[model samples]
Target: MLDATIASLSELGYSRTSTTEIVRRAGVSRGAQVHHYPTKAELVAAAITHLFHEQANDVANRLETMSDEELDTLDGIDLLWGALGGPTYRAALALAAASITDEELKPVVTKLLREFDETLVTNFGKYFNFNGEFESFWPIGLRFAFSTLSSAALYRELGLEDRAEEIVTVLKAMTSMTIKQMGKNSRQFGIQS
Candidate 1:
């Protein structure tokens, strides 16, 4: 059902994805969907949560197979883009936009997004070597990368696929340079770990 909901959201957008559509796609009875998710908000929240966890796990599994030399910042960004710049993330984006004015869904989406942020941070921390002194800056840098990648994904959805590719390539270069500069000037900037 969750998979069906994700497909529905990706293909139909959040506003157009109905319980009936999800039920039909899942080949499940309306009663089962109703029993699991009583409202659209609840159903979407569950689907987004499930998707987030799956993406995180996918990244982690990929990281496990990579050697340290293959786990540079650019590689990390690529991994993130691979995991998030796709249909599932598009579905989540629809839910995120809908949550803006949806009072009932706002809190749920907010909470799930925050948790997802933390999960990404944790996952990156496990593989990337953010020096102990610059640990506090890790999340800030990661959030910037995530925002840029997310915007690129949106641009792709808007039919600007080439521009999206350019944005991602530029983002990778910019992020790599910024991290190198930060490492070099951390002490000069008084940015203590």
Candidate 2:
């Protein structure tokens, strides 16, 4: 049933997905689905939760082989930007798009955004060991990365694809400059090129 929900959500937006569609796609009786999910809301929520877990797992897998290392804000930007530009990010965005019309699913999008922003800031401050302190740059760096990545996603939607690398490069440079200025504002941490 959960698998069915993810499939349907991936195919259709959250709002367009119904219990019937999921059960139909899953080849399960409505009774079986109801027995587990009880409500469409619950089922979709589960699908998103699954998506989140899967994404985290993928990140862990990617990091698993790397040497123990900290990721700075720019590194976080690169890591996250690269990840989201991949298939997982694609599916997650599609799900959230469909869910936008659904009040209950709004939290899923909010959760993803909150996690993205907070993780970028926290990991950057602690790991990646970027020199500049978080005070001057965390907020701006986060917002800039978010906006740039969101635009990169939009670029794909607009059929102007193949520019993710270029876009990410420019964003990295911009983020780096922001951090450079941050050095003057803070002595907490700073990463030198």
Candidate 3:
């Protein structure tokens, strides 16, 4: 059911996703779906939560194999773009936008988003390497990285693959510069290497 909801949101979008479509895609009865999720918002929220966990775990696993020296903003942006900027993110985005006016789903979606942010920060924080006075900028840097990369989804959907790549390349370069500045600032602040 959750899989179907994600698929529906990815392909059909939020306003078009219907219980009938979800159940049909899931190859399950309406009763089965209703028994599990009493409302569409609940089902969609759960789907978003499920995908969030999956993506978070994938990132954590990828990071586990890498040494600190092997990490950089360029590689980190690449990972984040590939990991969080495709169909899964599109699906989540749909639900997130819908949740704004969807009173029933708002709480669930907001809670899940907060949890996802916390998990992402905790899991990927070390790769950022913001030390000393640069620490406060860490979250803003990540938000910049993710929001910039994730924005490319719309371009890709519009068949603007080249444009999307161009934008990502530019953002990746800018992120590298920002990371370098952070390191320089940390050193200037007497943060030992």
TM-score (all chains, Cα) for each model: 0.89, 0.73, 0.84
For 110-192, candidate 3 gives per-residue lDDT tens digits of 88877777777777675566666667876776777677777786677678889989989999666656656655753332222
lDDT of 1 by residue, 32-106 (tens): 988999987788888988987887788789988887666667878888787766688888898899889989878
Preferred candidate (TM-score higher): 1 or 2: 1
Model 2, position 56, has a per-residue lDDT of 58
Specify the highest-lDDT model's number.
1
- Which stretches of candidate 3 lie above 4 Å from their native place? 67-69, 182-193
How many steric overlaps are in each model, in order? Answer: 1, 10, 0
Residue-wise C-alpha lDDT for candidate 2, range 1-193, written one tens digit per residue: 7776777665675667799999999999999888988998788777777777676555555544444444344556666665665445555777767667867778876786677556545544444444435556466666677778878876765577788667888887877676566554322333335
Give the Cα-based TM-score of candidate 2 against the true structure: 0.73
lDDT of 1: 0.82
Error of 1 at 120 (Å): 0.5
- lDDT-better candidate, 1 vs 3: 1
Residue-level lDDT for 108 in candidate 3: 85
Give each model's whole-structure lDDT: 0.82, 0.66, 0.77
